[model samples]
Target: MTEPQHILVLGGGEDQLPAYHEARRLGYRVIGVDRRPDALGAAASDLFLCMTTRAPDRIAAMVGHLDVAAVISPASDAAQESVAELSRLLGTPYQPAPDAVRASVDKGWFHTVLDRLGLPGYAYAQSSDEAELRRAAADLPLPVIVKPSDSSGSKGVQVVADPAALPGALAEARRHSFTGEVIVEEMLLGRHLSAEAFLRGSTLATIAVTERSTTGAPHMITTAHTVPAELTPSTEIRLRSMIMDICGELGHTDGPVNFDFVVDAADEIRFIEMGARLGGNGMPLLVRHAFGINTYEAALRLALGQPTELTPRHHRKTALRILTADTDGVLLGVDGTDAVRALPETVELQLFAEPGSRVHRYTQAGHKLGYLLLVADTHDALRAAQARAESLLRFRIEPATPRAASAAAPRSEELTEQIR
Candidate 1:
């Protein structure tokens, strides 16, 4: 009897569970990796390794003896470079090179690439030193955005509308950065949008743009995303073309690429960042629901060096409502979940927090409590369903006192169980 070929999966979180399930369904042995032992996806895999996916060489060295055929880091930006490196080491056919992955993750490097390609130029500066960051921010216009150079899920992001808040924002950004580096950019004001697309040979096979809603101001965390974003035909076409051009220039014209962009007041596409991997926050689910295609399976096939099709069978309006808290507290309970789930348009509902789990203010994507997925026959229907669901779902939290808050800070493992 022949041994089953091992497929290395870099993350074993809830968001990464689909990839693991897909790999197993495709008759491949899954080797899941994560730093936490209690990862939800770990139980789903044939084998699980308690280790960080961020270190490529280390992972390769540890798992080299296994019959690993292909490697993938689904729904994670932090582990992408490792996926590329492991692919190279294992002789897999992952399209992105290590340098390209690094460029995609490193905001500073990607901004430079945009400038070199003569794309839309947004004034930005980056540095690890406080003095240098301050000096750079001084040159840019006020009301800038400050964030870690290489972090995701909107972690440590701050909008500095006031000059007095710049220092505090910088400190917050630096605190989240693994390298202590931060990027400050002049705020691009307009409709915040995101796209999920798959590329095959410099051409996009499938794409979907979403209208993004965020918690306003200081910490702009995503709250909801509605697919088939309300846009004129010309605007949609231009945005698609712009994304294609940017992907081609970045040398990420081969697999799944998720993008964050803004359609500014001048109707210009302000490209924010791109990830050479599947997007988190139920992006694949949204794509699947709206486009009648499975990007997760497409991404899996890409990792396996197999051809995958992305032709949409049908189109439908879909919306995702991210569940969040209004204030920092321990989750006492969530009411009306049954009522919300009973709605006709409610397709899926997930609750990440238990009664006693600590939940925080909606400051970043990582702070999400849960999400509601809805589908409808028309735009109006979708909007109505979204509103109805929001009103139906109520979160009861016991607000933490100042001293208790510091002492009872939620551990990463706990949050990983609840949020990620």
Candidate 2:
């Protein structure tokens, strides 16, 4: 009899939880590692290893101890790096080399490669100094975007209209960037969508496409994602082809990759950015619900050198809407969860923050308090249900006073610098 496969999953965020469940459902031995002892995914895995994903030596030691058949990270860059390093040490099949992963993580390198390949995209400049950024702002067109070269969850992305505010925006971007390098580029105005693809060797298999709804201005964090994106068949084909070309150019193979793009009013698709792992915050769930394809299972199979059955079993529309507070304050309570749960078509409702926990001004994806997942027979129906669910939900926070607000303002910047 063949031995059961053992897979090591890095990090214990909600994104990695589904992979852990899927691995167990497939009868694979699962080991999860996270720095926080209270990480939710850790509770669901066969073995929970408490450690940071960036500790390469420690991760390597764990992989050796487990004799893991394969190592993978579902939706985190740190986990992706760990997977690459562990794979190299264990002589296992990972997605790419450390250098390739680095190229993907660093936004500056990613844009440079896209430009060199003559891909349809805008130019970008990376700078750490205030003077360099001011110069770059002067050179670029108005309404350019500023963001960290290596960060996720739309943490430091900002669309600046005036050059006078460039310095403050640059400082904000730098606060979220570990490398202290920020990229300023021409902002593409269009409909935002995300595409996921599974690669086996040189073959790229396109997954479902979804329309991404993000909080406009002040916060560009993704708020909602709906599958079977209201795109015509031809447009969908064109976007998928472009994404496959990007994957080929990047030499990404044998795992899941997500690409975000902007479809302008002219129907032209422009690149935004791409991640080497699965999309976060219930994206994999939507993919499975819409097409009956399990991204988590496929990722594990590919890492183990096994063939994946990339067949669609059903066609249904699904959506996930994040619940965010409008202001910063202490979270008093969450009401209407039970009401939302009683509603039809509401598949899941989860809250990430606890009572008494402080909630900050909505800045990025991480600031979201929770989310609701829904499904329906049609896209319109799904959207309607989502609207209803959101209406029934509420997050109550104690309003801050003037003196308290002043004290809280510094906390935001401090937290931002820590995450960087």
Give all TM-scores, in the order shown.
0.92, 0.88
Question: What TM-score would you give candidate 1 relative to the actual structure?
Answer: 0.92
Off by over 4 Å in 2: 1-6, 46-49, 95-100, 399-420
Model 2 scores a TM of: 0.88
**Model 2, 1-420: lDDT tens per residue?**
665567888888878887888888877888888988978777798888898887777877756755578787887865667778787887776546444487557877877666766767786788777788788778888888899888888888898987777888889899988779898888888898887767666566647678988877644678888887888778887777776666767777566887788888888877777777888867877777777888888888878777887677887788878778776778778777899898878877778789888877668776777768788988778878877776767776664556655764454322221010
Per-model CA lDDT versus the true structure: 0.83, 0.77
For model 2, the run of ten residues with the poorest summed lDDT: 411-420
How many backbone collisions does model 2 have?
0
Question: C-alpha displacement of 22 in model 1, angstroms?
Answer: 1.2
